[model samples]
Structure formats: structure tokens, C-alpha cells
Target: MTSSTPLPPEGHGLPQEIIDTIIDTVSDSTTLKACTLVRHDWLPRARQNLFCELSFPPATLRGEERWRSDYEEVLRSVVMDVAHSNIKPPLSAAVRRLKLHFTDTSSELGFLEITSQLPFKNLHAIELLDSDLYRFEDHDQDALFLFLRENPSLKELRLDGVNSEPKKFLHFFSRLAGLQLQLRSLYLNDFFGYHDDYHEPESTFLHSLPLLSNPPALQTLALHDVSRTEADIFVIPLLTTPSRFFDLSCLQSLEFKFPFIESDEAILKMCGATVMRFTIKGIAHRIHDGVILEKCFHHLSNLVRLELHSVHPDRHGIVLLLLEHVPILRRLGQLSMQFVKAPSRVRDSSPPYTSAEWALFGEGVDSKVDQLMQTSNPSLKHITLDIPCSWKNVTEERIREYFPKTNSKAVLEVFRIQDS
Candidate 1:
């Protein structure tokens, strides 16, 4: 007699390669877990994909928690296991990205040692976020220098609350000059102060960055606070090097969040029409002007997204000027304006000039924005208007009226009266 036909396999039983593709597309961790249970054959592929990104909450110390006492006992037992050394093998082999967050100075060296043991040769990206950083003592500085020297294959580097003498930063960067590691992105956040608290030799480390023998293949550079002065001699190297980056075609995003007292011309020229995303924060009135920015936009016709913060009303004329000058900006997808309050005068008028106020806002800002939208750029999508919470003169009604409704089906949103 013929045997009963076997039941059809459960699910599609997708090929192993197709499963791997599905894993790669997912960015959220929760979804990865569900995928793992699909089948025994899919387990290894799911695990490898999920563990590729390792995030360390470095702020938590070894003995900070009372519960950790029990944890430590268990941890020690696991470390002493016969196969403990093999633990790094599978993890290191799959990890391509690492995000580290540290809160204390005491654990800096310990953190370094832990990272050194990890297999980082295949690592491509690293993001460092430190809530509290130690003012580098002599030894701490040396250890950091050594860590960078060892991790020469790094393609992307991000740092937050990193403290060091400017000279030391330059000294460390100088060593990596010849390696020419494929560094495509650089992000740095440092405490901004008017004075130089940490002293170093006369040889300023800030200048030494551009002088590196072979600049890393940088495509995206973000500097939160590099300097405070308006001196061109100091700001030129950082702002004027887009063309120099390897595969200049890849350079698209640039950010200058520091307080700079200098010209925007070089920055405009360096971008030279190809820059797509640009962000500028903390502008000092005396050093920069609207006209320069207008010219910059003229040159950088490709800019698609712009974020402007801490700008004075007088400087607003610049953004308006830019809207008129940059033809390509009509395609701008997102625009954010972070405005500071204009000092108020005690107006004793009986009735507030409601009509005048509306007219003024409409003629000045609203009209300019409408004109920009009329331009042919199809990409202009979202606009966020951030105004001080205390500005009583610009009422909610006036703001709503100023933002003309577009037929784009909320594809372009306009927000007003954001919290200061």
C-alpha cells in the first residue's frame, strides 16, 4: 500500500540567503527576536544579524549597584569557565558597529582595556557618548592616544563630551596621518569656553589637523565646538577642505555648531554647490552677516536641508536673502529655525497694533516663505518655526495666519511657538 504523503513544510521555509537579506534591513532590535523563532535553520543567521551592533552603557560601573554583588559572583563564575575565552570569537566576528556611553573618569582606562581585547579588525563604525568626562590627567591622555593608534582601521568616529588639550588632540590626530584609514565620518563634541583652561606648549594643536600628511577619506565632518575666535587663520582649515576629502563626490553633510567669529565665504566656496545638508549653530553677530550667507547659498545651490539656531533678528534678513538667492533651495526638504527673543520695550499703547503686527509678520517672514515655496523645487517638505515662549507680541492667531496652507497635503508642515 502507498504511504500517506508527508505534510507540507510550515511557513515559506525561505532560502537561507533570503532570510539573511531580511535580517539586514531591520534596524530595530525587537523585530529581530521574532525572526529568530521562525526555524532552527534561521537561528544562526538571526543571531549574527542581531549581535552585529553592540551598545555599551559605560556609565554603569562594576560595583555601583548592590544587585551587582550577586551579578559579579555569577560573572566571575562565567569568566572562569573553560570556554570563556571563546566568548569573544563569535561576538567579535559578527560585530560591525559599536556605540559606547561612559559617565565617569575612573572607568576610562578599564573601558579602554575591555575594548582592546575585543576583535575590532572588522569593525567599521564607532559612536562614543560620554555624559561626564575626566579632564585628562597625564596618564589618561596617553592611554587614549594609544587606543586611537591601535584602532587604525576605523572608518567612522563619533565623540561626545571629549576633554583634552587642543594640542593633545592634534598630536593624536597627527599619528594617524600616514595610515590613511578609510575615515568617512567624524563627529566631535567638546565643552565650549571662552578661555583655554587646559594649557599646552606654544605649538597649537588646532592648526595641526589640516597639516596631516594624508587626510582620512572624510566625507562628513561635524565639529560642535572647535574654537570661539573669528580668526580666519584658525577656522580656514576645517571649513575649506571639502574638495580635499577622498571621493569628494561622497561629501554631503557638514556641521559647524561652535561659536565662530569669522567669514562664511570660505565655507561657501568649499561646499561649491554640492553640499546637500548644512547646519549652523551659535552665531556671534559681529563676526558673521546675512550677506555672506546669501552668497554662500548662491554658490551652494544643491543644499536641500538647513538648520539655523540662535540667530538674531537682524540675521534673519540673511535667511530671507538666502531664500531669494538659492534657486535650488526651493527643493529644500526640511528647514528649522531656532530664534532668540528680541528684547521687548514697554509699549504703553492702549490697543496692541493687531493689524500692523499681522501686516509686519506677513510682509516680512510669511511673504518671503511663500515666495520660496512658489519656486520650482519639489523637495521642500517640512518647516519648523521655533520662537521664544515669552514673545507675547506674536500671538498664536498671527502665527497661524502667517503660515499659508499649501495644497501639498501636509507634506510640508509648519510649526510655531515651540518651547524655548
Candidate 2:
């Protein structure tokens, strides 16, 4: 008898759902491109992942002239593809997020105009980075406004390193308020208001917007690296008066980097009832304030996830004091403590802690963990320690030695990070 060779299995033998699940796990663009050529049935999902996010000029590009030229070319190619692609829904329809870097230069205004005209039906998030909106001409500002207005599906907006005059910024929000888009998340980092009137209170800028009285309900809000004036003027007012821009009662996540103050305490009192996730970033020494521990956690009964990010070496016993306030959170499940090294110019130049000092500190942390385990029941499922790269080994060893119970239970996780 002659032996016959068996043929390779067909790709169609696997269910489409399984194929999609496998493709979803692939993140490399090169691999995704290769997957598209393997079977026609895989093309839609592959293209969706490939075009889900569109960034102008590419993040790796440097130099203004080079990036600007690349931006124009990419924009042109995208527009042409959208208009002429043979695919049913078109490649642009798969885009869900856009990241655009803008400048005050006149040439950039032209780019903005062209961007405003692109058709992105499913776009939901927009990030304006390193932009100086204060210098935009009337037409340029109108173009941006039109772009935002056209995207009714937009639900997340992030402004990073963006500057605008107080009046102009307020006007922008006022127009956005008119759109009545249901924004679910907003992040403002290194945002500034530029004007000669430094004496004016910050609240006036936000309070003046009549249309913002009933703004969209946001689920997540983040304010980072904001100046003191901006915090006092914008952040405090927004947090304290949730009805103006957000419904704090429905807010699920809040992240901010601010020195604890009476206003911040008041914010906790308001939103603490429902917020399930909370993150606070500050200098290590200032994070464990008396009032915060005494007054804040009591109101956060619903908190499920808590992240304390310290921008300096936490040698001042923040762990014990902060953890002392955790027992009140009956629903707490995840806790993340991060120690970030500050910049060299501002960092303390003290010598590394001696082994004796590490042992003492570890004991305190261990005792706190013991109390949490005894009192928190099974709700405390995971604990994470994010230490700076330089101290990762020492910290992990000490933590594992001191927190033997937690380590053995596999509830402890330690990570080495370059920066926070």
C-alpha cells in the first residue's frame, strides 16, 4: 500500500471569533500587516487595529520642518485613502483616537484647517499636545471649534502643555459646553493661562462661563503639573462645584497632583461617596498630612483602588501613616505605592539609606500590612510597590523579608520603573 501525504489545515477551520481573539493580542504593526495578507477574513480586524489611532508627524520624528512636512504628507495620504479605499467602511472609519501636535506658526494653521475637514466617523478621543492656542487667529480658532463640533462621538479630551489666554480658554470651553457632548474623561497637564492680569482670581475665569453650569458628566478627571494659581482658580472650583462641569456623585476615578488643602478636603467630602478609584501624587514628605488621614479616608468608604504616588524618596514614614487610613476602606481591593525619584536639580542629595535604616522602615511597613490583613478581611487582594530602578533590588528584598506573609500569599507585586 502507498502512503498518502496529509494536507495542511485550512485557516477557515478556526472560528472567526477565535481568529479575532488571537489578532487582538497582537500589538506589533509588522505582525499585524503580515496577518492581513494571510487571509482576507482577517483584513478588517487587522486594519481596525492598525488604524485605530492616527498621530500626525509620528511621535519619533524630530525637528519642526521635518515633522511638519511629514504631517502634511500623512494627512494627504489619509484623506486620499478615505476617499478612494475599496474597503466597505473605509480605513478612516476605524480610527477612534487622534493625537495632533500644534504650534503657533502660521503654517500650522493651514494644517489645522486640513485636519478639520477629515472625516473620522468613530473618533472618540482627541489630544492636543504642545499647542499655543492663545496665538491662534480668529479663523484658526474657528477651524478648531468646527473640528470639535463635527465629532459628536468625542468623549475624551486631553490638553497637554497647552497655553491660552484666560478669556480665549474660557471661550473655548463655553463653545464646547454649547455642543453638549457627553465627555466621560478630561485630562489637563501643564496647562496654563497667559495674560498680564496676574491679580485676577482663577475662579473668575471658570465661573464666567454661563454655558458650563450644566456640563457633561465625567467619569474620570486628571489634573497634573498645574500651577498654584491654576489650581486655586480652576481645579478647586471645578472639584468643589461638580454640578458646573461634572456630576461628582457619578465620578468613578479622580487623579490629581496637588498639595493637600482645605479645598481638596472639601472635594473629597463631596465626591468620596461614590468614587471607586483615587490617585494622589505629591512630594513624599507632604503626602501624609494630618488632615488628609484624619478627615479624607472616612468619607471614601466606596474606594476600591488607591494609588499613592510620591515624587521623592519616601523616607519620612509615609507608608505607615498612609496605610493607617486604609482600614476604613472596607471595599478596597488594590493598593499601589510608587516612589519616584525627583529631578536632580530638586532632588535631595542625601546618601543612600544604610541597611539598618532599611530594616527599620521595612518593619513599619510590615506591621501596617499585618494590621491590614487582620482587619481588611479578604477585600485586600493585591498590593503593588513601584520603586525607582536604583533601589528596586534593596526595596524588594526588604519588603519580601519583612512582609513574609503577604509575599507567600502571592498578593504582593514589586516593579522597577524608570520614572513615574
Candidate 3:
């Protein structure tokens, strides 16, 4: 009688799941290949786990053939290997997230084509980072658009460190809207690198986007280093009202970085929104004085949270703005500040105690926080100040001298009520 012998477990008698897990986290390709050879049963699992996110090393293909043949072969192999695998579905279907990370080397069209083949219908999120695809022709941009359009499950899209023409940027927005898909979050940072042809202002682009009949279901929008030099004045009025386009509603959260917030006019226009959360970043140099801030924040009566980022001590104007405008400050739930460098030579400046500068710049940073409580921000519970400072910087020490250790009786009472 021939007895049936059971096959031994794969990978040192461990099960496939454990082997898969190990393969999933392994970063070294040589080590992974060695592990795969441990058994035939382990091969499929190991390959799936390992090559699901394949990154080509330029060192593997060097010389004249690098351009004409090797790049294409490597890319085509990676895509076909992942897409045609019988062990599972397309890599995109299984991939919840994908990141196209490029090191300090030039990548060819082969890489772009591989990305284009990636099944986008199942990708929940994707980030395109630090790529040197400088000045792709319209055809390349259209291919990317085709991918985005087909990505029904994609909810978040982030494009960072991409250098392209302004027309390409506009094309991206147009394609996204044309697809009429649902995307909850979108972040574009340095999408258009310093293009000299962008001689106009930032507002110009802002005003035009909303007019699109089919904007995505964008709940959160963030733009950084997007020069507002051309931001049209009409955009201010356009964003002030709540509007809906396709799946995208009025933005629930908005963040503006750098030069966009440099003008109180822009700030005032944005404050008109009934948005639940608002984050502003800029220098205190342009907020003018307390009076202007008051006017600017007047429309933010419904603001549930306010985050401020400024670099100057003159932000005492900001304190007054908060105190006067956020009277329902008790209703405010969150406050944050991203502070820049502190001023030098305390003694060389105004009286630390009497100055509004002290309130904004000096010791009792906490007590000044108390004044914000007079408003209805009763729900206020979280406060965060991401203060990046140097250890040897005396400015931090000088500024800490006035931080109020205690809140006002009214604020304490509100805390009590909320806690109860």
C-alpha cells in the first residue's frame, strides 16, 4: 500500500499567512528571493506580498540600452507580473494605498506607463511624490487624467513635488470635475513649480474653479506654496456662500499656506464662510492693527474652530480680533497656533506687562487665552500651538514668562459645566 505523506509547512514549517506577513514587511529584495525558494507553496504568496509594490533600482539597468529598451522591459514586466497573476486580483484591487516614490534619478515614460496600468478602481488613496517628469506633453497629462477618471474608489488624492505647466494643472482640475467622481479630500502642494509664465495673481484661478458644473465631492482642500498673486477678487465672493457641485459640497475644512493669507482682505473674504474649521497661515506683518482684525473676523460667528499661524509679535492685533469677534468664543471648540521665530532683545522692546505685544508675545499666553472665553466658545476643549523653537533661543524663555498658569473664573465655570 502506498501511503500518502503530508507536505511539510512552507518556510521552516511556518504557515503561508506568517510567511506572507514576513514577506510583506521585508525590504531587502535578495533576502526575499532567498525566502521564496524555501518552498514552491510559499512562492506565490511571497511574490504577491513582495512585488505588490515594486520599485525598480536604476543600478539594475545601466548603459546605452537604459533608454531604448531596458526601462520599458523592466516596467512592462513589473506591471504584467502584478496584473496577470492568477494567485489574486490586479495589484490595484488589493492595494488600498500606493505611493510612487522616486529617488534622485531621472525616470522615463516606462514608469509612467506602469502607473497608468495600475487598476485605479480599487485604490482608496494615492500619493505621487518627488518625481522628475519635467514638462510632460499634453498626451502624458491626458493619460493621467484617464487613470483618475476610472478610479471610482479613490477618495483621497495628493500630488506633491510635481513640476508641470499651469495648463497641465488646470487640466487636472478639469478632468477631475469631468469624471464627476466622489473624492473627500484633495491636497496639492507645489503642484506647479516656479513657472515664470505665471506672471498673474493666484485669485484668478480660484474664481474659475467653482464655476465648473461638476466639481468633486471635496470635503477638505489644502493648497500650499500656491502663490496667490493672481487669486482673483471674485473668488472671495464665490467661496463666501455655500454651494454644491456633483458630489463635492462646500468645503468643511480649508487650509491656506504662505502668501495666500498675507492680506486681511483675503482673510476677511474667507471668514465669511460658515465652515466648521478654518486654518490660516501667514506673517503677522500684514494683519494691520486690532481694528482690521475685528472687521475681518466679524463674519466668523459660526466658526467652531480657529487655527492661526503667524510669525510676528505684532499679532497682538490677532488677540483683539479673537476677543472682539468670537464673542460666542465659548462656542469655539478648538484653537491652534503655528508660531514663527520670536523677537530678540526683550529689554530693548516695549514694557512686557502693559503691551498687547506681551499678551500675544509675552508670558501670560494662557491668560490672553482666557479673554477668548468671553465668547460662546464654551465647547472649547482642545488647544494646540505647534511651536518650533531652538533650545538655545532666549526668545522662548522670555515669551514663557507671561504664560498664564490659570484660567479666568468664567472659563473655569464653563469647563465645569462641560465636564458635568
Alpha-carbon TM-score of each model against the true structure: 0.62, 0.79, 0.58
Candidate 3 deviant stretches above 4 angstroms: 1-81, 84-91, 101-111, 130-134, 191-214, 230-249, 258-272, 281-296, 309-331, 338-364, 375-420
* Per-prediction tally of clashes: 1, 0, 35
Error of 2 at 193 (Å): 2.3
- How would you encode candidate 3's per-residue C-alpha lDDT over 1-420 as one tens digit per residue? 432443354324655455567777873378888866865665655655554443343334434455344545565676677667665445555555666654443354545655687654666677777654455555665676667667777778777776654544554555565564577787666644435676555546544555545456567766665545323322222233223222323557766653334343454455435557767666454433555555545645556777776645555554444545555443567777655554453223355443433434454344566555444456776555544442123344443444433132322211101100
lDDT of 1: 0.54
**lDDT for predicted candidate 2 compared with the true structure:** 0.70
Q: Give the TM-score of candidate 2.
A: 0.79
After the best TM-score superposition of candidate 3, give how far the Cα of residue 149 lies from its true spot, in angstroms: 3.2
lDDT measured at residue 19 in model 2 versus the true structure, 0 to 100: 72
List the RMSD of every prediction in angstroms.
8.2, 5.9, 10.1
**Span of 10 residues, lowest total lDDT, candidate 3:** 411-420
lDDT of each residue in 1-420, candidate 2, tens digit only: 422433236623565566778778894378888877877767777777877888765767645575564666767676776767787557568778998776445345376677777777678999888887667667876777788777788999898987877666656655665574578888888878776665567667666766455667778878777776666655565555554455666788888674555556667788777889989777455444667665777878788999988735535466677677788788899988777653333323233434433433443665576557665646988888776765533556755666777787888898878864
Computed on alpha carbons, the lDDT of every model, listed in order, comes to 0.54, 0.70, 0.53
Q: Any idea how many clashes model 3 has? A: 35
- Lowest summed lDDT across 10 adjacent residues in model 2 is found at 342-351
Which of the two candidates, 2 or 3, achieves a greater lDDT against the reference?
2
> What tens-digit string does per-residue lDDT give for candidate 1 at 1-420?
432443327644555555668877773478778766755555666666776776653335543653233433333343244124464336655667777655454343344444444444456777766532334444544554455555656688787766543344434444444343567887766633222554543335444445443456567767676554422333343435432323334567877762332444565565546777888776434444556555566665777788877755544444555455545565577777666664454223223335434323432655576555554556777666676665656665555565565323353443445444
Please give the distance, in angstroms, between residue 94's alpha carbon in candidate 2 and its true position after superposition: 1.6
